[model samples]
Target: MADALPWQQALWQQLASRRQHAHAYLLHGPAGIGKRQLAERLMALLLCQRPTATGACGQCKACQLLAARTHPDHFILEPEEVDKAIRVDQVRELVGFVTQTAQLGGRKVVLLEPAEAMNLNAANALLKSLEEPSGETVLLLVSHQPSRLLPTIKSRCQQQACPLPTRAQSLEWLAGQLPEMAAGEREESLALSAGSPLSALKLHEQGVLAMREQVVEGIKKLHKQQSSPSQLAEGWNGVPLLLLFDWFCDWAHIILRCQMAGEEVDLGAADMHKVLQYLARKSTPSQLLSLQDWLLAHRQKVLGKANLNRVLLLEALLVQWAGLGGKA
Candidate 1:
C-alpha cells in the first residue's frame, strides 16, 4: 500500500523534501481516498535505512522488514474488529511502545488509523504519547472524521489535510484501474463516492447502483402510501446501512436542490435528476431540509456504532419521508 495515488505525488514530494518533520502528523479527509496508503508511504520513507528524495529506498533491510510486516520499530493501532471502537488498553500498549528505543536504532513509526474510532478512554490514553513521543518516533494518525476526535488529540499533532481528488482526476484514475468499465458506469461510481476513486470502485463492485435504484423506488412508493417501512427495510437488508444512509443523504440534497433551483448541482445521472425532480414536486422543501439533517445525524450515528435497531431506525426515517409532499 506504499504506492501513492497520482494526486498524492506533489504532496509526497513536499513531505520528502522536509529535513525535519513533526513527531506526529494527523492525516484527515473523506473515506477511501487513500489516506491510509499515504500514511503507509510516509512511514516507509521514515523507517527506510536508505530513504531517497521521493520516498522509501524499497531495497533496504528496513524496507524489506516493513514489507514483510516484521518491522520491530513499526506498530499499527486499529480497532480489533471492523467498525468497533479502539479501546483504552490498545492505547496503553502503544504508550509502552513509544517509550522503548527503536529496536533498529532508526526512527520508530506508529500508525493509528480511523483515529476517531478511539473512545474517550482510548483517546485520553494516547495524549501523553502524542504530546511527547520518544525522540525520532513518528506518529501518523489517519482519520475519516476528525471532528469527532478530542480537541486535545487534534491540537497536538501537525495536521495534514488529504482532500478528495477532483472529478476529472478521479475519472482518469478509475479508467486506468477499470478499463473494461463503461464510461457511464465509471461516472456513476465517481458520483456515488462523492469523488473518492477507491470508494467509487468498491461501490460499483458491490452493485450499490442497483441497490440505490431500489431504495429510490421504495421512497417513491412510500410517499404514495403504497409501501411501508418494514417492507422497504426487508428489501434493503442486503444494502449496507451506512451506504443506504449515504445515498439518502445525497438524494435529500438533490431533491432540495431541484425544488429550490430546478436543477441538480451535487448529483449526476440525468435519469436520477428527473426522478428527483418528481420527488421534489411531491415533497415540500421544508420536509427535504429536515430530512437531510436527520439523515446526516443518523449517518454519524452509524459510523459511531450507536446502539440502533436498524429496521426500526430505517422505518422511522422512511415514515417521516413518507409524510412529505402535497397537503401533508
Candidate 2:
C-alpha cells in the first residue's frame, strides 16, 4: 500500500469500509499539500480487489497493474501542457471512458488532478458526468481551489479537505525525512515549504533553500543601499518568479507575526522588514490585499510574454514596493 499521511489515514479507513455510497468524490486542498497523493492512494485501494480494511493490498494483481501504470480501468485527466486549460474535449473523452466496461470486471476510476484547471466548457462537460455517473465507476476530482469549481460540480461530489501540517509537526517530519540536512537548512526548508512536506522536499532537491538565502541576503543589501537594482536583478536573473513570490510572502508573514507579537524581529541576513514596515504604515489591510492581487496579475502577464524585460520588471516592482505611495 502507498504510504498515507497521518491526516489521511482515518479518511482512507472510513472510505474503505463504506465502499457502497457515492461514486464521486472531491479531494480539495491547498497547493502542494499532497491532495493528488491521497487521491492516487484511494484509487489504488478501490481498484485492489484484495484491499485491506485500512488500505490497498499492495501485492494484488490490480495493485501491480496500477504500479506499472497499465491498469486498464484507470484513467487520468490532466492539462495537455503546463498552464494550459483542460479542454472540453478532454472531459468528453473522459465521458467515453466512464461509460466503458471495467477491464478488471469491477470498478473503473477516473482521476482529474487540479480539476480547477478545467475551463468553463470543460467544467460544464464534467459536471454533466458528475450529475449522473454510470455503474460502479468512481470519479475523483482533485482540486487546490474547490471554490473555483462550479457549484453544480461542488454539490455533486463528497468534498474532502486536506490540511497543511502544523509547524512543529512539519519540523519533526522534515527532520525524520531529511536527516542529512543541516539544522539551519532544515528549518529554513520547512519555513519555505509553507507547511507542505512535499514542497519542502522539492525545494531541498532543487537547491532552492540555499538560493532563497542568497536572494534574501541580496534583498537586504538592496534595503541597505549596498546593492544597485541592476546588481540585485543580475543576482536573481534566472530564478523562478514563483520562488521569488514565495520568499516575499514568507518575509511578509514574518513581519506580520512580529507586528502582532510586538516583539523585535531578527530578520537575520534579510531585513526587508524595514521597507515592509514603511509600506505597512502607509497602507491598510485592504491596500495590502490589492497589492497582492496586482502581484498575481503581473505574474500572469509576464509569464511568457515577449518584449517584456524581466530584470526591469523586477526592479520596478522592488522600487514600487519601497515606495508604496505610488501605483503597484
| TM-score against truth, every candidate | 0.92, 0.82
lDDT of 1 by residue, 143-168 (tens): 99899999999999999998668888
RMSD of each: 2.2, 4.1
Could you tell me the lDDT of residue 89 within candidate 2? 96
Q: Which stretches of candidate 2 lie over 4 Å from their true place?
A: 224-238, 249-293, 296-316, 324-328
- Model 1 clash count equals 1
Candidate 2, pairs of clashing residues: none
Scored by lDDT, the top model is 1
Clashing pairs in 1: 282-325
